[model samples]
Target: MRDRFLTGLIGYPIAHSAAPAMHEAAAAALGVRVHYQLIEVEGAGRDDLRAMLEGIRRLGFAGVNVTFPYKEAVVELLDDLAPDARAIGAVNTIVSDGARLVGHNTDATGFARAIAPLLASAPRGPIALIGAGGVGKAIAFALAGLGVGELRIFDADAARVARLAGQLAGRHPVRGVASIEAALDGATGVVNATPVGMLPSRDSPVPDSLLHPSMWVADAVYTPLWTPLLSAAKAKGAKVLTGRDLAIYAAADAFELFTTMMPSTDVMANAFDAVMAARYSPPA
Candidate 1:
């Protein structure tokens, strides 16, 4: 049998994802062969998810990246969880070990790596975070571990925000605020963890008026790269962090989990940029 690895991403609406190119390029840089596919699982029920996981195992997938809607749910289907994944209550990466399926959360580490430089100079104070779902939960834990003194979380679903805040309270001072304005109050760094600024619609979670030049802003939406929130923050003269770095770092971590080897992240990043340019640039 040929020695090659197989992997893919599991998510609804994954047509716009850049993961395939990023991982495949990393595999190339590592001098290994990997086939990455997109397994769109929109409208899938628990049974469907279980069946899909079974199919992945039968097909000998090295691992798969979980995104949106399924990150938390996938935890229940796994045989084991990494300590951090269990603590954060989400899994963005899953690895297959013989008959065992293990889950891990690269999002937390990825977010920390992406935004550490920006937070280095800023004082330890309140950080405003919007959204409390899968990706949001991971980012919250990451920020808390990075020494964010306070976390102000807001979500349209108050219950989600409250739940996330409760989970994070032991590590950092967390508050589930009722409104975005309340979350931003006394905040020096702002993060948009929701899907508000993704493709199709150009809406941003935070308005330009709410952003200040003194604050640093970040968004988790990367399909468009320059998301509406990032644009508004840039216009307001605020330092901005795009979702691109988070995507790259997360995928790099997942790549290591799958292959048990470190891939050239710089090569993966260049591949992501090339893919984006090919998709977004005007045709000749």
Candidate 2:
């Protein structure tokens, strides 16, 4: 096992991230010392990202986790990508060897691990997936790999939905629908992959009326753990899964990739929960 390592995360608006604490705790549990920094390159464009990546390599970073607004953008910047990252069209974790940087998509497996307990059996019913951006794409691939019968996708950008459906057509039954209602038509599960329900916003991507008691709901927004979507779904008697599990699972995988050592899920999860509770808890 590596005695020491340096890792970090790159993204815009990363002030809300609990990744540093989570990664440090995981490293400690693995008997390693990891200094995980928050590289907040807000409002950075493609060229800026290239410079940032080069800088990290020169600075001897083990690797960096790429987050929102940069997951897809980092794909072209990497020297190579793991098969899953290539297939998912997103890279959430990058590993730097002295020679070159390689990318991986832990989000797919992370989502699968997070949603495992929520699924009593492999579902064969269509799933309503909203949003087709980076995280949405990863979740789409994860659900497909989970043996979902069909994926009904809806995105504000029609072309985004078409591209995602086309990318996934060979592996699963996918449909690019015109509206959320159409996506939810025969779906037994609903996932909100959009940022509509994230921090500072009280809105839900799926309207309460559209949510039914029979459907199980999941949200990728962990900032507000009980997102409006999950709240509404719970109110309707629907089974619910939050993004916290996904975050912890993804962090564990990223930690492993960065350090070449497995991380303790329990330690990482506890660290994440503590950070979120401290930051988001009301002032006493």
Off by over 4 Å in 1: 1-3
Q: What's model 1's TM-score? A: 0.97
Where does the lowest 10-residue lDDT sum fall in candidate 2?
115-124
Computed on alpha carbons, the lDDT of every model, listed in order, comes to: 0.90, 0.90
Model 1 per-residue lDDT tens digits across residues 1-284? 33478999999889988899998888887778989989997888789999988988888999899998899888898899999999989999989865888999999999999999989976667899999999999999999898876889999999998789889877788999999999888789999999898898799888678898889999988989999999989999989999999999999999999988898889989998998899888999
lDDT at residue 53 of model 2 (Cα atoms): 93
Candidate 1: global Cα-lDDT? 0.90
Model 2 quality (TM-score): 0.97
RMSD (Å) of each candidate, 1 decimal: 1.3, 1.2
In model 2, the runs with Cα more than 4 Å from the true position are 121-123
Which residue pairs in model 1 clash with each other?
none
Question: Tens digit of lDDT per residue, candidate 2, span 146-181?
Answer: 877689999999999999999998899999999999
